[model samples]
Target chain A: MKKILIITFACLISIGSFAQGNVITKHFADYQQDQSFTKVNVSSKMFSLFTEIDGEDETEKAVLDAMSKLKGVKAVVSDSGTDGAKFYREALSRVQKDGSYEELMSIQDKEEEIMFMVRNDGDIIAELFMIIRGADDFVLMTLYGEIDLNQIAKISRILKISGLEEFGKLGGN
Target chain B: MSSRFLIYLFLISSFSGFAQTKLIKTLKEEDKIESSYHLYPSTLRMINLQNDPAFDELIRPVKKLSFSILKPDVYTSKDMHTAYQELLNEGYEEYIEVVNDSASMFVVGNESKSRTCILVNNDEEYYIADLEGMINVLKLGEVYESIANQDTSKIGLGTVFNYVMGENNEKRERAKRRKEREKNGEKEAKKESFQVTIGEEDNEKKDTTSEQVDSLNAIEEKKENE
Candidate 1:
């Protein structure tokens, strides 16, 4: 009985350690508990609806395909009461320590730091993370999918998603 | 003989000061042209409630709506100025005129119960909302606060007034929801669905309806995702 209890406890400790080290999961939990942020989680089915958009150009189609494969999307937008810069710095350091995400590009434009990070295996990008920190706005978006940086840029232009134009430029860099 | 005089006096009082209701007459005349568009009462009631609920109470008593936004190259500032003079001559009282850096909005209406709202722009665009009830012009203005981009403005207002009049993804989604609710024996959902016909033909009068719905969907989807 003592030996069995020891083995089960060891397994539980390893699992707990694994979950805590993931910055994305940790931030999602932290944001949900904090009232200052508006959080949204969209399922894969909802993401697939982007594919149904008619009259899309070739680039739009490619982006839609990548979007459709997304497992899920999560975002948190902080309100005025919270200090965005502090939270952004904290989150960035945690993600850096997590080590799976590698910084793809970073832009420091007047009173804001926008960064894009990705987790990839060879040419296939497994996940994409975007952290935007501004004077009044702080947004962290996590898209779990096989997304390419070049495709994200094309999607941004067609959909007119502001600040995402930088992703297209990152490919050339 | 006194009663006869009273009847004669009533007829004269009713007929004397009225300016012959020229606004509705002008709208009917303009509607006959190929370019102008009007939304009749039957169409106004069909806007999908899930899209914008503001139209529900606001457009209830609207008898008809006619609007036209001419291409910049086709109509000039001089023509719009001439039309403004014609509206005043026809007894349409000018209410509010808004001039911003982007564009200008002119609003004119009669003080009577049979209100005729004529909104003209310096860009040679036009908007006419012929209502059956007494509507506060200021309240009606609130409904159109989201409108921008001259060409889309007409379709956006039209979509608000008549969403089902357009080809929209919301129409299908609403229908599916209605069906699910019906299967589940939801009374309110059934009532709403029955009020507005499902699978109706898309109004071909304006090809811009779908484009307007697309713009609205794009904006709303972004908000929803964020």
Candidate 2:
């Protein structure tokens, strides 16, 4: 009876932890298991490389400065082959129930919608989660560690990376 | 007057009048278009944005906000880039420009004063915003980010215009009130009332400066370690 009770308690603890897993880890695992999703993981060390990317513009230097503070970034994109709508809905619900995040903004057009959420420690944003659900595409991106949208926007501008400038509207002092 | 001078004046006046008439006609047509929207400070303040903290500072200092959502394919990528180049040629200083796979954002501002203009175009639609007053160029990203977060269909461009105007009005009113109180010889009263507020602002500025310093130090340390 005692052995059974201990095992049951351990199981409950594990389940609870799983339910409250790190936002990126929970979704990233799903991306890995599903062949339909494209997962892109850029570790902290790799983020530093953004600083060295050649660009004559001053914004390039700003991007390097911003990338230096970044810890990690993970993105999961669903193509036409995947049930993107289903993944979008599930991810949205999961983030909604997750206590660690605060919904910052949401925009929708026709059948497409995008949501921005963040986990901040005081003024410092630790994580930024973006969910984009379109008619044919769905994307989930989570950026970790002192994430500053201004710097990210500058980086995007310098690198000619489309759609990243939208993150700059995330709000800062 | 000489016959030649009379003839020149007649031709110049006629052409000027013709050009003015054409300009007036174009302005009237634009005003009649239902697709366009205009918002003032009073109308903007009335919009309830659910008091979202993200917009707390983003909307301030905006004297006006106006945008028109154009249909897809109306302006090709080449056309957009050409227009940006024209603005540059016209001596509009480039503030910040971002060209990505999906869309592009271009900003231009005056050398002196706070007047700014932003143009964002994608495959589907294009938008233009004219903002007055002091606006931090860096914070424009946050403004765009906030816009990206909203339900464009539900909120429409009107909401953003109104919100910005409303915040601008609020700032104006506060400044007006302060000016009036000062004129009434209530300097001591004003000092007492704004003591805490001024202290808080000072502290906030100090905190921001310190954080930037620390971040710079961290970057230097990382470079050394590398």
Candidate 3:
């Protein structure tokens, strides 16, 4: 009976780890089908293809190198309607409750609120999550798999991905 | 019977390669959407007509291009969403989606070799482009910037469509110039008409010009006397 209890606890721990990796998908699954929300899911295969491109300059090369390490990117954006702030708050509360991600930076003003968080695996960052809420826009984006804080800014600048600019605050790690 | 079934399956699999093309064709035919198709050569020619080598380089990897415009009355935002879902079901992965108050766009691609479609729906109309080939998706923003920032005078609707589809004004102009040159049997004048005379050559040419003017005056004086 003790052995059986130990095995069940081990299985639960493993499942929890798996769920931690997919926190964004688990939390925002409803937005995937909602017509009002714009959903984006870029597979690892696309990032791998970026590695095959020969960068034309040093900055491009650095960006490509950083992108190559990324496993995938998922974003759920709601720019229409007035529920942006509501969605942002919901996502924030859920992420906080999950306790897998640590908040890195947050900014709140009269017009907008932006938050940046990351899930770390040892010394390397495994995931970077961002939630931005403006007057009528909300964006929740997560980039997972082998992230480098030092190169995140460069990647965001070159890619010009929406809501990624918030992660640029990480500077260099 | 088994061989026949296998042959039918093979035909079905082969048609999947042109899924985006087939979709555009069907949309145009069924909904009567205004659409235009340009093959590789015509697309290249259109890019070349821009006279910007950079634009040509930007579109180098595109094998074919097609554009369709659907009026908002005919294709509502709900209809656009349904079409987007249909595209996702067709094995294309959504790379990015941007939605703003005025417009929304979805960029999706199947594989590196397959077509990348950009569907932009706004309050006014729905614009779709079927681009077949391995276009670097990363550079799409750059392409949009270049095209958007282009001088409006240079990119009239007629120039992009009528010019590529039927008329070739540039070619006609070239032929007309050639015929004029052949009729006169004179080579086209060099771009720079003024000759450069350095140092001593400059002084000598000035002196010769004055001497020729004096001689012409002398000849006129002699003719007047006669």
> In DockQ terms, which candidate is top?
3
Q: Would you give me the overall lDDT of model 1? A: 0.52
Model 2 vs. true fold: TM: 0.36
In model 1, what is the error at residue A102, expressed in angstroms?
0.8
lDDT by residue for model 1 over A41-158, one digit each (tens)?
5445434444544323675467667656766556666765557688789779878887878998888878888888887756777778888888877878766766766666655443
Q: Name the candidate, 1 or 3, with the larger lDDT value.
A: 3
Q: Model 3, chain B: what is the TM-score?
A: 0.53
Give a tens-digit lDDT track for model 1, residues B1-226.
1222211111111101122246446534655211344555466556422334443544544455554334343445555566667767766555434332323444444444344444334323333333333221112222332222223324434345343223233544676788887787777778678666532433442446888898999999999999
Clashes of 2: 16
| Model 1: how far residue A71 lies from native, Å | 2.4
Q: Which stretches of candidate 1 lie over 4 Å from their true place?
A: A1-23, A51-57, A158-173, B1-226
Poorest 10 consecutive residues of model 3 chain A by lDDT?
A157-166
Q: Please identify which of the two predictions, 1 or 3, would achieve the higher TM-score against the true structure.
A: 3
Better of 2 and 3 by lDDT: 3
Model 1's DockQ? 0.01
TM values, all candidates = 0.40, 0.36, 0.59
**Tens digit per residue, CA lDDT, model 3, B106-135:** 766667447667677655456666666544
The weakest ten consecutive residues by lDDT in model 2 chain B span B10-19
